[model samples]
Target: MKLSVWTYEGPPHVGAMRVATAMNGLHYVLHAPQGDTYADLLFTMIERRNHRPPVTYTTFQARDLGSDTAKLFRDACQAAYERFKPQAMIVGASCTAELIQDDPGGLGAALGLPIPVIPLELPSYQRKENFGADETFLQIVRTLAKPTDRSARVSCNLIGPTALGFRHRDDITEITALLNDMGVEVNVTAPYGATPADITRLGAAHFNVLMYPETGESACRWMERTLDQPYTRTIPIGVGATKDFVEEVAALTGCIPRLDTDRLRLPWYSASVDSTYLTGKRVFIFGDGTHVATATRIAREEMGFEVVGIGCFNREMARPIRALAKDIGVEALISDDYLEVEGRISNLAPELILGTQMERHIGKRLGIPCAVISAPVHVQDFPARYSPQMGVEGANVIFDTWVHPLVMGLEEHLLHMFREDPEFNDAAGPSHHAHGAKQVSDAPDPIGAQIIWLDEAERELRKVPFFVRGKARRNTEAFAEARGDSQISVETLYEAKAHYAR
Candidate 1:
């Protein structure tokens, strides 16, 4: 594999960990080397999971390569099953271990384990994390899910919503509430809080709600094809999309779509006079395909922002992302390279950025405001507050998350305009903070004689706000100097304004 300091997605095994981690009564036995154990910290630290992931690593060292590594994997699998007593287990090889070609699947199958043993044949060199999650979930469903009697009431399985997803937990809560309000029952939420038994009960649902397409699409397609259960396509992230999702569910379950938008303040706040300035603010978006597509619609339609550029790192989503980008009059950036994404962002110089945690760093380095809209996020993105990115409550969260960066930037600009003030100097700290203040020097007096302004010119300059008078004065003097005038007049001041306006 090509060496890079950072990657947008990890090897396929990490994706397998995501699926295994999201579920209950399911264990993943990974035939890996010693260093491969680092995936544990990702869940415990980044996702802030209270417990370690449900995984057992063979953790064979360099010395063990000369020995029977296959025996080590078998022992680990047996130990995992005995220790965890899971209802189901999956076995796979990490990227480095794949080179040994121990055949983890075949080796796992040889073991006469009482529980269901599903072997995963994931090509580490070819596929990425999302694909691994999708494949793993699909395998589990294929092995466990069976056709059963449908529920008396209309119900659906909430497919997707795995661990490490950005706000998946909160999104599930919001969507579940929305479905309950619509008189629909949720059969089972899979992959996150599901068990092997839940997979079997999936056939009981009348339909499926596919929340995340990247990790759940394959599994949903299988259920739809095999179990005769249809699934919803519309993801309820924004006001418009949520409405469409409601209507889609209504059609599926014969429940009337609740068009009550009275709880939504995004439309009203967006159209308010105070937010008019936010209109036409250019934005660059990059994330997973699903989030990028949904964020584009919200950015352009809901928030009145101009989408200058849009793309995703997930190649599986390239076609739809490209189609959406074409509709918006821009090329879809479908590369995993952050450097290329940085170059594109630099060329576009958007006023705002809505993307993943990687793009958050890119924005900070470029001094652009950003909001996290997708996965691969840091621990900070997993806040203690109830922040959902779907349904009515989710719409409110989106409004705050997207708008705060711009408003905070404006606040910083205002503070900088008054930086020379004794109370507002850099050393003085923010007025809202409780830090101690320090004295800061103002600009020293001019060394040489400067252009003088007439009484009318000075009065006209005062018409500009005090905070920006220095800029007006400087521009007026420069204009007078360029014209070879000895003093600045009212005409020169107005002329400078016109020159700058152009």
Candidate 2:
């Protein structure tokens, strides 16, 4: 694994925990060290779950290496089964426990538990959280899912709603509501509030709705190949996508596509005169693949924003991101490094940023407005309010969530216009002192003392907004320095802008 202070996704076992925790009548026995159990807090604290996740960790210490570490895993599995009385159990090892090679799965299998015992062979060194979740979900479905004659009535299974997702619980509600409105039945939703029996009845559904591609697409595809159950791949995150999703589902189910335009507020909201200020607003997006791709489309199609930069930290799902970026005539930023994302954000100087909590922090540092659109999220993202990122209601939520930060555009423009007046500055003192003062104190001079600039060039730089003048000046100076010029002229400044524009 690469060294990082923070990561977009945790190790494979954390993913397994998500699957185990999201389901009913399922328990996970994790063969792990003491520190590995910290993943529990991700659910209990951040998600504000009242009940603990159904997981039992061995918590084996280094001293246990002298004894039978395998026995500790077995005992944990036995205790978990007895205490939870789960219909099924999953056995796996954490990153550190994998080094011991105790084969927790084999140990659990030997006990002859009454319930199904699924063994997870996740390579923490090679795979990440999303991969683990996918593998675990696939394993559970493979073991429990039973084939049956396709029902004449239209029904589907919603796959990929899991614990710690970005508003997954609400997404299920919204999607369920939409399907009900269209007279379609939801047979089951896997890895999220589904029992082992629900998994067994998966083949009863006529189709599957693949929500998050990273987590459930593999299992959905497998079902399609093995069970002859078709699935819809559209992710209904925005108005256009939601409309298309309804149409696609209708076509598959032979049901009439009906949408209450009033319910989907994004189209109306975007078309309103109040949103005119949002037109051509430069935006930067970076996150996990599903949200990144969906948000990019919404930004460009519905929000009238110019998507200057787009990316994802998930290397496994980078292909679609790269394809989307290529279609938009820009290179996709595919890397796990937050620094690379931060640097791109710095260079782009977008007016708005939509990304994870990490990007929110970077945008805050750079004095740009940001919205959290994806996971690796903070507690603030998991609000008590219903905020799904799917269906028509989800489109409304996205509109409000993304637009609120930049809604004061007119007021900000007026403030900038009147900033030269002493009265205006005095009136804005408190607000400026709280925000602008820090920026002024922290920022170095735009034209550094080391680099000389001609009067015309300095005058041109002054025309730029104070917030961006430093970056503009730095870029110009770097261009002059690269050309071996000691002093910058207005011609050089324009040349630099043109060069950078290319």
Candidate 3:
């Protein structure tokens, strides 16, 4: 509802469109004004989808406000059904359309269409995109899924993936491959490359795999409760997570997963001497709940990075994020304001940032390397190459994606060793310096020169790597000030480091 240059999520209707677009033979009838059609560009331009989203917008202008907007909505629904011949249809209104008070769901129901019409009553002012998608997907499953006493097979349904998700296509492929390797058949993948028939037959699966927690959790919980079916909560985004996911699936469906550990290169890569520099590298992570939580674990446990800060724009999932942060001994940042995220990033001054496109921009401005791990992404994040954020292959992709921006351990060591050499520190500066250093250096000081540093402490601070020296200096000064010290000394710096280490 708050107007800004940037937002973490789109409107509720847009989430409905994502669900409709991801499924086959399913159409979305959005009661919206002309400008609202811009959601189509997200799929076409960013996802590079060949076909336009199966969405029919009323596109009523201000002039039509005086007219019968209800009739306009009915006509739009009828036209969408006739043209698309969809097996199922979802009806909803955009934020502006919601103010007009036109009952889109009621109108669609009155249309008397041959196909099933799922009415979406999403409160645009109260909810956002992920919530809408979750509701829409849940409604579709609830309406289509029928209770049956059919015996379960060695199969599962992958739930919660939709259009515009972060690398969802590749993630689905990777997960499908892994399931195949485990000799488990995928019965259906709802709201993403699934059909109306697939949704109706969801109960045939032995269990459900919750891929993205944001959109799939509700549906999985409903299915589990109503149908007495179990689900795996493990998100296979990292090496450890993938292994855990496989084990969880095995436990749920009693299908022994034959995982090829050799295919998962992240474990070996992280243990290699070349990746030694990655160890203890400070990282700031902010994104949706699933990616932020998974990335925090991967960065800390697998890639050997210290999660200096972690957060998510998805406030509904804040509790889990806060718990994860507490376990890591860091406070969780739960906010929608990009400025707050930017402020935290500046304060933390992490070496690498794993988040959305907005974080990428923040990292760029801060001369920090970043990898896109969540949605509200940019076109660059949707690479032509297959890069998934799930399964064994996904762990490998994450390792490369996050590590590519950082200097190798050997390279970093060489730079530090020859830093004082004239050839190494030429007038043009070292080759290892970030290209955006000028902009980053021009950033306003996060904390002013309030705390004085003694000459000995300043000299000791310079011994730290330049990339982390600023954070080290700030931490030491803050520690001294907290203990009522007027000035920071070499002993204070060591004390701060030791305190932080514990």
Candidate 4:
């Protein structure tokens, strides 16, 4: 409602669209105005789907409002059913249409189409995207899911992979392999590759694997009460969590967990000598609650990074994220305002950021390296190759995603540190062009005083890895200036490192 250049989540109806588009043989008819059709771009352009989303907009214009807009909605609905002939249809009003009180659900029912017509009473003003997706999925399940006999072998409905989600396609692939290894069959992966028929057979599954609580929790809870099916709580995104999820599923399915580690490399890689530079590196995390919590564990436990700050934009997830932040000895930020998030990142000045696309922008502006861990992402996040954020392969993808930025950041820092050195300065040009490049002179220092480094100290500094030499030089200079010493020696450098370690 408060018009902004960017938003973490779209209007609730957009969420409804996500659910409708994610499934097969399901369509959404939205009673919206002309401009409301723009939601299609989110799917077509960003997600790069081969086909347009399964949505129909009753694009009522300003002129149509004066003359019976309800009739327009009815006409649109009849046309959508005739054209798509979906097995099920979800009808709702966009924020603009909600003002006119067209009552899409009631109108949709009156038409009496052949297939089941599920009505969505989405409060566009009161709720946002994730809530809308949850409510829509829940309504569909209530209307379609039938009581049935459970499968002979233990099976689960993989709940909550939706359209426009961050890496849902690949995550499913990685997770399915993990489940198969434990001898559990996936009954169906819903709202992503499912149909109305799949929804009816949901009760056939022994249990449910609730992948994303934001969109699937409500429906899973309802099934728990109505169908006597329980769902898994842990999401398998990291090494530890994946292990926990494997054990949890094993208990539910009575299958012995394979507990395989042959494909996992993060555990040993992070502990290796090459990764020592990652230890205690300051990091800030912000995204949806699921990813924020997952990234926090990976950063602190697996990667050995210090979590300088942590937060999420989904206010519904505030309580748990707050609890997480408390356990981590930091204040939890539960807000949707990107400006406020940017300001906090500025204050924290973390060396690295793990967050959404919005925070990716913030990190760039602040000169901090970032890796996207959640949604509200752009087209680039949807890679052409496999890049999941779950299971062992996901852990591998994450390791590459998070560490590359930090390593490149170190390279940039080293570049700045040696800017005055003729051999490495801007004037040096490319290695291939070095013969034709012009030589450059060092600029005079604008600051009156400078701490000189002794020959022995400079040699000792050179012995440090080039990637970290800049940080060492700066720390030594700071230590010298703090003690009123005009020069830095080997002793000063060692003492400064020891002081910082303490």
Top model by TM-score, which number? 2
Extract clashing residue pairs from model 3.
Answer: none
Q: How well does model 4 score by local distance difference test?
A: 0.86
In model 2, what are the clashing residue pairs, if there are any?
Answer: none
Model 4 Cα lDDT, one tens digit per residue, 1-502: 6988889998899989999989999989999999999877999899999889898998988998789999998999999999998999999999999999988989999998999999999888988999899899999999999889999988899999999999999999988988888888999899899999899999999999999988899999999999999999998989999999999998888899886789899999997998997999889999999999999999999999999889998877899999999999998889899999998886666778899999887765555678999998999999999999999999999999999888885675566567678667543432222233321112112221487878898767765643344456666777778899988888998999999999
Whichever of 1 and 2 has more TM-score, that candidate is: 2
Q: What TM-score number comes out for model 3?
A: 0.88
For 1-502, candidate 3 gives per-residue lDDT tens digits of 4668889998788888889889999988889899889976899998888899999999999999999999999999999888989999999899989998888888889989999999999988888899999999999999899765544558888998999999998999999999998888888898899998888888888789999888889999999998777998889899889889988988877778678888888888788997777889888999999999999889888989989999999888999999999999998999989999998988777888899999887776666677788999988878889889898788888888888777542355467567778656522322444552443322324452567778897767656655665667667767777898877878888999999889
Candidate 2 TM-score versus the reference: 0.89
Candidate 4: worst-modelled 10 consecutive residues by lDDT: 439-448
User: Which ranges of candidate 1 are over 4 A from the true structure?
Assistant: 422-502
Error (Å) of candidate 4 at residue 192 is 0.4
Off by over 4 Å in 4: 421-502
Per-model lDDT: 0.87, 0.86, 0.84, 0.86
> Cα RMSD (Å) per model?
6.3, 4.0, 3.9, 5.5
Worst 10 residues of 1 by lDDT: 439-448
Q: Please provide the root mean square deviation of candidate 2 (C-alpha atoms, Å).
A: 4.0
How does each model score on TM-score? 0.87, 0.89, 0.88, 0.87
